[model samples]
Target: MNLVLFDLDNTLLAGDSDYEWGQFLIAKGAVDGPHYEAKNKAFYEDYKTGRLDIYAFLAFALHPLATHTRAQLDAWHAEYMETHVKPMITQTARDLVNKRLDDADLVAIITATNSFVTAPIAREFGIPYLIATDPEEIDGRFTGEVAGTPCFREGKVARLERFLEAHGTHLDRLGSSWFYSDSHNDLPLLEKVQHPIAVDPDTVLHAHALAKNWPVISLRGDQHA
Candidate 1:
């Protein structure tokens, strides 16, 4: 059996969902527009350069979840799906996912974005498995705390191992394994796979992909591979 992992935010979608979610909230007046956008954009820059402190960013990102009721959050997220996320999805991305679903033994979206934000996106891609950061919850409400390791950078490697362990398998047990990502931040997990594909990658990953002779491809028309 083989494994195929796709990075959700920028790889499968034309844009970054986490950053877009923050923008979405700002547009909806859920957050102080200028203040939130400034911090969100700064964090995104850090992420692109592989300098992000996941904990600090999580604290910022998840706090709004704690302040809102589950019902309200769900309603907003439902609207987010229709307004922000759905438009980000493209036919090429969907086709790539469909191809993997038919060809791979296990296919999952591995993203640093919290499960709350990424779960429905995974379902929209028809991917049955997702490996993402988990936000703490109690009594059907968010606690604005991380449940375990944030699935970012090296944490993605650890999370994938745990996921494989839960299935009584290991990376070595797979006939082949592949990971597709657009960020340099994902280098750790990208390096773990037998095949590391840079999909419309950032400057850093683009250089690394070229140096390592890794195959680079683009699912979105606007991106250069």
Candidate 2:
């Protein structure tokens, strides 16, 4: 069976989940309004420019989990899924994923966002497998620290390799593989896949996709390259 991988944020959703999560927390007063919002925007800009420091961003992004109980976090996330994330789920994105699910034996959402934030999003897409950055947990509470290599840039390949090894399979074992993403940060995995699709890609990734003669699509509108 073929393998299909989808990037969670801008690729499948019309927006960035990590950035929106921080905005949600700020609106809820879980984080300082000005300070948190400023940093969130800065971090988002860094991500767009391919200059993000995953560890540093995690310290800021995961701080809410450390401050609140798991139950509280869960409740907030439920609201987040309902309010922020659900609206971003366009019919086009759903159709794309459903099509892939029907065609592939294994379908997964691979993202740099922490599991705490993305797990439910994956569920919403009906994707059974998720490869996301893990937040350190002690006694069922987050430490606001990353557990392993943050799944950004080259780290995505490392994490996926480890995941495949645990399943007693490798990239070559799959008859064919497809990876859909928007950011240049996902170039490592996109290049690794046999069918690399750029969905609503940013400027850098869009240019790279054109150079590589990869398929470029936009769920936001009727745009294709």
Candidate 3:
């Protein structure tokens, strides 16, 4: 089956999941103060502007809970999905995903967001595969460090490569592998796909898409990459 990879966040959701997730933590009492929100918001800007590296940005975002146990983080993630991110999935995107599945496409989510956060979103959508940055754990506690490469920018392509290897699939073998993304940060993956579609593209990606004759579509113009 052909692979249909999708970026999370703005491509799938209307807003930044990371910032909202941090807000969830603060609201749930899992984290304290307004610093979490500030840090996450700033990280979004830095990431979009290509200022912050993926690993460092994630570490900074989660630093407040560095001392929390893995179990605690897991519970928090579960709650965050149910109470925060789960309800934010746009109906248009949901319809799109359903249509792709109906076509028997091999669906997967490739995001820079942490696996702990993206797992539930993927599960809710019934997606069987997800490739995201995994946080390190030791002694049943979070180490505040990434276990592997932070799946951002070109890292998304690297993770997809590993996924293909594990599943005995390759890009060239697919009949019509497609990728949908929003941010300019995902340009690497967007460029690698056989069918690259810019969904809710950012300014940089929008211009490139137009200049290259790439498809630029939005789910009701709600995409703000």
Best by TM-score: 1
Candidate 2 vs 3: which has more lDDT: 2
lDDT of 1 by residue, 82-127 (tens): 8889888888888899999999999999999999999999998899
TM-score of 2: 0.96
- The most accurate candidate by lDDT is 1
Off by over 4 Å in 3: 220-225
lDDT of 2 by residue, 58-158 (tens): 99988888999999999999999989998888888888889989988889999999999999999998999999999999999999888998888899999
Error of 2 at 84 (Å): 0.2
Tens-digit per-residue lDDT, 1-225, candidate 3: 688988889888776777788887778776655876677778888878878677678877656457776678778877777677756677788888888877856889899988767888888887888998887767766677888888899888899988988888877777888989888888888888888999988899999899989999886444321
- Each candidate structure's count of clashing pairs: 0, 0, 0
Q: Any residue pairs clashing in model 3, and if so which?
A: none
Residue 217, model 1, lDDT: 97
| Whole-model lDDT per candidate | 0.93, 0.91, 0.80
Q: For model 2, give the 10-residue run with minimal summed lDDT.
A: 216-225
